[model samples]
Target: MPREIQKAYKNQTRSVDGKPGKKYWQNSVDYKINVKVFPETRIVEGSEIVNFINNSPDELSEIVIRLYYDVFKKGNKRDSRVNPKDIGEGVELKTIIVDGVNYDLANSDKIKRYGTNLTIRLREPLKSGQDLKIEFEWQQKVTLTLDRTGAKDDTSFFVGYWYPQVSVYDDIFGWDRLDYTLDTEFYNNLSNFDVNITVPDNFLVWATGTLENGEKVLPNNIYKKFLKAKESKEVIEVVNEKDLEGLKLKHNTWNFTAKEVTDFAFAMSDHYLWHAASVNVAGKDVLINSAFPKGKAEKHKKLTSIQQKVMKHFSEDVPGIPYPYPVFSTFIGLRYSGSGMEFPMMANNGGSGVPVTVHELFHMYFPMYVRINERRFAWMDEGWADFMENLVIHKFFNEDKSNSFYSRFKLVTQGTLGTIGDLPTVTSSQYTGDSYGYQAYSLPSLTYALLYQYLGEEKFFKCFNSYVKRWAKKSPTPYDFFNTFENVSGEDLSFFWEPWYFEMGYPDVGIKSFEEGKLIVEKVGYKPIPISIDVVYKNSKKSYSKIIDLSVWKNDNRTYAIPVPNHDQVESIVLNSDFPDFNETDNFFPPLKDSYEEKGVKSSIVGNYYVEDYNIELSIAKENEALVIYSNSWVWLNTILIPKDSVNFNTSDKTGVLKYLEDVSGRDEIELEYPKYNLKLKGIKK
Candidate 1:
């Protein structure tokens, strides 16, 4: 554990309600951005003039603009403390050229340079429905961070946050005050963007929004060829002919326009090998473009398939809500900064493989279109993206892949849930101090998994669709999403979100004991919503499950002894064996000793049922006044005791024996004296 984690855990406190604190939805904002990219110079310059149409009933003063550049160039000293290359060539704010001229507003004084974020304060007090125009020319040489932008080697440029961009203004953080922590994600308002990019003629430009000057920007003859290709829906190749010498001298530029976009990014590459596929996403004829090097053509194809599947899933899952774009481009490149990132119609994904592509593609529906402020409520975007990605992967590749993502996600959620001190969900900024890998990506992904488990697949999907429809093209706070889901599902989700977000705690459950056709399970520590248990009986036989809701209890420790109606017909019980539970290390069954004692009776005991590692042992102990069997690890065990008079017990009536034991136990402690029995079990470390 990191020192920070240990400190947080040691100082952690509990809320009065024993639930995570409440997170209210902040005020929403909408924006329209127009940008232009110079691909050859690797520069993306744009302006976002926002109308502060405050939907909230409160009057607000000045707004703060977050340009992620401050995190890299704080104090203008060029700190080499963090990732050296992330500062890249080092970012510099050339000028705050508003409406083409330098405008120093009163709020501009607060424009302190942070690590990678440039905080520009608004000049005047803007009331609801008021508008402001601000522009700045900033450039980044592009370095590699966890997910934002930079170059992998010198061959590729992962261009994102590679420019001085606007920050988000919401009710929660007011202006998102946290520094650029690696684990935290982003949050921005929805806006329209029109970008005109000028790049080298040899380089192909892939960016957000629609190409405004595709024909005029390309070589005259090549432009004509492209036009013809668009009309004929065929691949148009531009041949290098001696007569086209003049065309080669001119630089080609691709201008794009996009509406209701949260952010803007673009990539330029001369080595790109491009392919386009026309597919119908939600009755809308859209083009899916894949851009990669020649060596990655096969990977691009796989990405296309994943995109197709995601689009299909989105279309079917969210009814009456179609994708609002003419094209969905999936760019695959080695320069990718992270697994994948979402733009308006285009998503830049790492060439890691199909999983990264699928995950990024799903982002188009959440923060990309839903327009949630990602910095404050990253879970809203990342969690939803992860959920959709898992769903699509499962639909295509089956449970194995889905299980892998799910298990990984669970670990993240469990880790975070177990660490954070009791803080209000609204004020609990997990992204603030956390690492980018955990805060920005993994934690949010886990939140989605827990939400899915709590709401089940049907209601959860409905709530998700409702969230998208209600917040599409508009800014929505964490509260807005929670309220929408809760209202639609008619389930109070405060209990679910409180512990998951505000207080970091994971489900650490173990099978306490199993005997007399009954199983007792106890939560060792942490309060997960409901314990999802999977009990397997015989080989190839389907498992039985039960969701143990613990929301009604305040204590962290609770035990439940459920009667097994068919104890005689049972084989073994596994807690959270389905991988739904976030923390599984502490999850096991039939305490080893109890399992071993029952092992000779045509029954098998399993230990570390959830995790691959760990060992199981069986032993005997004395209980009550009778001799009984026990498991070495009482974490998950089952004990069987025989009556003193039944020395010659009939083996023919195993069911009867279990039934009699159940009647005698009746959910209470069974007093028995027993001799010790030893059984050993082991497994390879995972």
Candidate 2:
């Protein structure tokens, strides 16, 4: 029997913290899982039994065990099956045994129910320093979906969180009672994991850790020998060749092992062709592996070459902390709904271009190696991931930082302008919807880009390394990240985070107008990011630039009309012409005409003129003046009367007055006016 605390003490403790304090119990978990696959049935049976070692000074009461069942199974019909569970074949609860005693599932306290996770109450609370063992058996039928584990193609499978696993109990949030949503990230403790996967005899496996039993597979003798090996042994042999033909299945069982991993997933396919290269990252040997179909093996080779280039580039940028694992595997299968996902030493990539592979692989350094609670603060993971990915792409591809990378940051920042009023990163619920790319991915990336601009490259990287080292394998909130930078750079950054993350506002710097040798700029919008204006103007035959100091206007909209000292020589002006400004449409001076307006003018109006009604009016000025006129109408003899002709004549036909002449000869000025004809004439002497 467990020792019970007095009601008075419990009430007193509850009053102090509003719940059980962190000192109530010590929680530590280690998992060992064995998974076997039947490729024909597309069914996977996973058995994971976790050992929870309690070390709290106080006696434990009820413990909650979470089975990530929602990742695999479908919920009931009453609950709309829109979750990952509803899409994939569901996993049934075969059994849940605790300490050799079977508990009644019907009467168990269901803590909370979402589509992906089910929480159950422990039968009896174990005391401090006590141990409890829980075993679960479930079958998963993998299907393709936007989240969770699923099949990408006939041969390659992308599996993750497909089994019932335990949730985390932390000092802060206790049980981490968050429903599995699209926007929310994941939080878990670092624990030891042992996984065993079985597939068709011919299939090759790529997993999270090192292969512990590579030498155990002898020709045609692995299966019989593997059965005799105990679970405690480090090596196991696998031999099953009934399915594969025309291929040697003699050495089959691929035994692997890893320590201190938060999650585990692997891909197996007979059709997968594999290639690997080893690189030294931070004095550690890291293997880079790629897998693709046989016909696309050459493409996989090219991808591996690019991967090496990216890995080397990241090492130079963010030095120290070498890759922990032996193998970094990238599986290229069919395109999934999700672009890319990062695991500890593995990443799933479905991008067609070179940048996608680099982006996904860089995650191994950011959130994967620097483990953070992704569910609570996705920006911490995704933002850093995107930032590092861009750095790698820019560095390796020799891309122009100001254009390709910074231009994209500007575009995404502009796109997310008005959406800041939607919700906070911690409170807003719309983060998981289709707009996730805009809010979660793009906005955070832009924020980092701005940070890079504010702190410079060296200080920004130093702050990044400090944050990664401090919060690795722990849950870090947005405050923790901000504080890390503040502490390292010795500068307060709350002002930066206020508008960038909390509020959705972006910088809108544009050229309001340029006239009379003055460059007028209008800085609109609220977000406080650095303003860089590139003033391009012509000086004589050459164009010169004067960079205006706009960084002072980060807070308020201030109009600046800077006078160009060389006004007479100025021809054209371009504001932020290099495309560094977030919005470039309003950056250019002498604004380009609208497409519709430009198309409206007649194409044949190059040399044509017309008057509403031709009434004969003539005027003459001094000598040496000449005039020329032409009329398409042949009935009227088109003639021009100049100031030099000193004579004037008028026709008196009344209705047929088609002729008029004026001759001033050498006179200084002469003017002719006809009141009856409703005509007036004026002339200038040259």
Candidate 3:
């Protein structure tokens, strides 16, 4: 279905069954940055030297650099709808050196710049299995641009994409030509960094890499607390108000180093709150931390606890893989949009709720560990993160909240499921109009949740863990994700992928008719949906979920019959099963067996009859396997949906004088031998 990534498969760089091909290869680099930030002037000057390694079998004629910060520059193409201000000057190249020779990139006619992408022409071809060192000095006026990498105030800043980063060169798309839009989709190769940051006194630096000279930069009192916090599981205040008030200021350089990371980012603030903690995940001390402004530290008091839980959940639950990074942090500062952005080891977040904390921290396992290009296939990372977000919320917070508006509010109410102007999730993030966030975030998340439900937790976890582990630290196309699930689950999931990703639609399964032990359902929409069956027979009552594969509708067969085995004289067979059905009119068996009272009697179903005079939309809510009908208009029904504690609740007799109870306002009243049209049912709540 994703024909765009087939070239990697054809070239043997990727396999059809979700594994890296025998000829798989990727380019890497080692970058060192020495930068000084003038917070007062809002300017940044940096010198970077990249040791680029071209280990691929082919030769290279040129290189591409990603000047992502240029998205803030005027006249550049941006995915963000916000207006661009020219307060931040575009990157000014001061000097350049290639290997041992100096190249005038500022005046070279061979160097080309277009928007955020720069194409550098090489003097000589860099042959296969060769390494080249490229150095450059540049400066840019720092602007706290919207979305990410912004300054909360003149003296506090979060810096990212400030330096020109080497773009990825892979077997699939040459040079990773995907443009650096405003947000999402950072396709990159694994790179190491050794950064030295120079800042004025009273400034604290938080970076992506591990701090090497913390003992030198931090005050002795705070440095002691920092060391103790990394080894301890409890939250430790590294810098307190006393230290802030008693600081002896001077210029200092903070040195940091990291290996096998995709990129490097750092935040410097003069008056910000810092919280540090640690969690033992996969036998390693992975630091759990958060950084925000003063007086707002209480908003994120439980952030580290949420991080610990998410780290343990994603590592032990579905897709059980170890936490790969040495640190995980949340940095919330002045963000225009109240949102969160995931970075390796750290996240630029806004909300402080535990669910949000879990969502951002779980991203480390996704694009951070399982390095998928978020630009082209945001669903790959966001979908998985959101899916796990609900799962953790279900297991830890409330299971009822997992599939409801209370937990995943953005998911159940929006996206491709039941919204207008929605596009296919497989479409690139740049082209999907209006509903890109919904399609990218929640639709595919629910799709994967449904897939997990269909496969059962065991098979689902096994397949998911295998896929993530296979692609850990590697850039994988979406096809790799599809193929791996099919390979590990031992089922061709093209039925699941095609409709959910390539097609633009939602699930609209309708019950056609029913008789004896067979019920037929019409697939009104292309999505293959799971069906729930609750059968109360004369002999026994059985409640079981049936997962119907998409292959059932592959042949243009719009209908399929599910035979209820050994269940005669059935009482009910509810469809949609309360799983966020957009329309619920045709959701149950015996035609219409739901009872409701919204305002007055808008419609009624006495026994097995549905009235056409005044009708209402009917849906079934299955909580803990008990059926509760939800109605758009007030209505009542008889001979179906009885209370669980009623005298006839377990009865199989069709003709029985059953006493029922109802609540008008507060008091409960009992009625017997009432008209079926005006029947009162128990367990009714408004």
Q: Summarize candidate 2's per-residue lDDT along 1-686 as a digit string, tens digits.
A: 00122332342321121223333332567788888877766677878888877754445455555445344344432222353434544566677777777655565363334555566665566777887788878776655554334576666676766667667665444566566643455566566777777776667777888766655542334334433332212222132232233544545666667676666777777766555556666766566667666666444557666766677677765534555566677777546423667777777776334667777777776666666666656766776777766666666575434333454454343433454333444433334454555556666776787777778878888888777776555545555567678878887676677766666555567778777777777877566544344333453455555544434564465777777666676544545432234444465444422311333422111122332234332222111221222233321222222211123322111111222222346422323343322344433223
Error of 2 at 472 (Å): 1.5
Candidate 1 lDDT at 403 equals 34
- Per-prediction backbone clash count: 57, 18, 4
lDDT score at residue 356, model 1, on the 0-100 scale: 71
- Best model number under lDDT: 3
Q: Give, for candidate 2, the lowest lDDT window spanning 10 residues.
A: 650-659
Q: How close is every model to the real structure, measured as TM-score? A: 0.69, 0.72, 0.80
Model 2 deviation from native, Cα RMSD in Å = 19.6
Best by TM-score: 3
